[model samples]
Target: MIHLRSLQRLTLAQRRRTATGLRAGTILLAAVAATLSRAPAARAAPEPVKVVVVANFENGADQGDAPGEFQFWVEREHLDHPVALRGAPDVLRRGRDGLYGMVLRHGVTDLAAFILDPRFDLRRTYWLFTGISGVDPRSASVGSAAWARWVVDGDELREIDDRTVPAGWPYGLWAIGADAPNRLPSDPNHFGSVTELSQLSKAFPLNAGLARWAFDLTKDVPISDDDAIRRARAAWNGFPAAQRPPFVLMGETLGSRRYWHGEPRTRWAEDWVRLWTGGRGVFVMTNMESQTNQEVMRTFGRQGLVDPDRIMVLRTASNFSEPPPGVPVTASIGDEGPGQRLAFDSNERVGAPVVRELLAHWTRYRDAIPGRP
Candidate 1:
């Protein structure tokens, strides 16, 4: 028989081993539980959304965050895996495969809020700014669409009343560092006089390759026509492109905050863009948001959040910037008729195909950004 002390020692040793094994098993289980809990968060992060459409309002109606003039792009395109974006002034709607859209109120402030929102991962995103704008009757008709090469800010200028303007000046408005209206300094680098706009808001030019690529994709796609649009085009008799049915053409934009209208203002827009672009651009679309959009992009671009070069602005004509040949400005402003609808429809008409092409060939462009001339 064994001694009691030795037996007790043997039993103590067995109990110690059992306790150690149990502790190890418990620790392993705890580690597994911790890992399992973290899986949900990893799954929750959404995939990156590409191809964002920037729109301001509903074509006719707001269909519960979608099917608006901007939202329609989501449904018609059948975008998938949509997730509502957070950390914005308002939640922006985003889709997984390709389409994403945001509705901005009519100003720089509203657009700035949305662009500065932290939740969006705009890196590698291709921003498509689609909106309805007043058309320059000289450049396009009521339903003509122009792909902008230069987005010129129309608000920044020195102005005198037209009645007291200097002789030979086209209008009251004059760009800084210039002798008179329509006169821009020959040297872009050195202006003899220091001007307010020299450092403030001025102009942004889109990537020529991308703008041209877009035009090539949609140039031949026939624009939808209707009675109202046809009647509007009839008034643009002298302008060959405008007289033809609604079509896509490459042009430029003038963005202003004042909403100034009339024949004189339109002439100013043309000259302003010409001066800013060194007479290389023709003003076709008059809009309110292009300058605002670029300002936001410039910030994001430095942070590597968005590629400013990839951003493209596409404007469709909703009304004439000035009255058609004989129509009075006051009467024309209120009577846009069906061209409003056509403008919305035409944006999608040209925009949709280019979007489709990108989606269809995702493999080629997934890692590489397109638009090389």
Candidate 2:
């Protein structure tokens, strides 16, 4: 009977220990689950984009074809991933280096469509607008590149036929509210007054410091100069700036839907840019899309869709805005001359470094723009 009681006591003790062990395990598991439940959830990674290269057009296949504004970039950058937007002619491409390139149509419509699409986010994006344009002979020679400090609109103006313009008027084109050419329109504050743009403004100033930075970064980079280029530049004898070899500079751009040529029109562009910018801007390049593009970007900026301060415009000189000495306006207007190829080469040479710099130290430039305090 004593042995039986001892065994029974031992069994009871064993049972108690077993029950306590199980309860402790259960409590430990419950504590672990509670802690996990209180912890924050893992967040999705942000969409990575270092730089977005906005090119105007492409000539052929993105690779293994004759180069265009977009082709060299696509090929050189190894932009292999293609994302096709439905109902769009060009495909958006991305590289593993966090670079995105898109060949936007020549005007505002396509850019607006791309920006409005829900497929991508661009609020943190940096835009580099680049293309070939008619270079003002007084500013820079063909094959030269200009970082625009201001983009002036040449289309929103009043014009009469140059032949029928009143005597002493340089050209028929003038500000919408102005009574005469070369005159700034009255301020909108004036009673019953039509002003420079009425309710709209003509000049869109880009980041001046940024332009200077880009110009400084690329100004020393060698531009393409060949026998063809030398021969083409030789014709600009009277214009000292145009006779020089290609280079990089800071200048302003004038954009219009209509393509106009001739010495008189060139003078008009120069004066128009100066008037709109309150004499702070100098016209250097001419194109068909910049004003419209800047307008769309400004609207997007107002809506919080983009940061306008991050935008940069780089235009290389594909041709002269007006004829060389003794060349007919019609002949010179149609010919891009040898500078076309030189411009293409110069654009890539000058733009690639800026892109690379942004990419190399993305941690710094991702939030802070270069040349800004």
Each prediction's whole-model lDDT (CA): 0.66, 0.75
lDDT agreement of model 1 with the native: 0.66
Report the C-alpha lDDT of model 1 over 123-212, residue by residue, as the tens digit.
767788888888887777766788888888776567899999977777888765566787754344344344445443267878888888
Q: Give the 10-residue window scoring lowest on summed lDDT in candidate 2.
A: 27-36
Off by over 4 Å in 2: 1-48, 187-199
TM-score of model 1 (CA atoms)? 0.78
Expressed as tens digits, the lDDT of each residue in 205-287 for candidate 2 is: 89888778878888899887878778877788889999888888899999887898889999999999998898999999998
Candidate 1 regions exceeding 4 Å error are 1-46, 59-61, 64-68, 79-82, 87-91, 105-120, 185-201
RMSD in order of candidates:
17.7, 20.5
- By summed lDDT, which 10 consecutive residues of candidate 1 come out lowest? 27-36
TM-score, per-candidate, Cα-based: 0.78, 0.83
Residue 352's C-alpha lDDT in candidate 1? Answer: 81
Distance (Å) between predicted and true CA of 31, model 2?
54
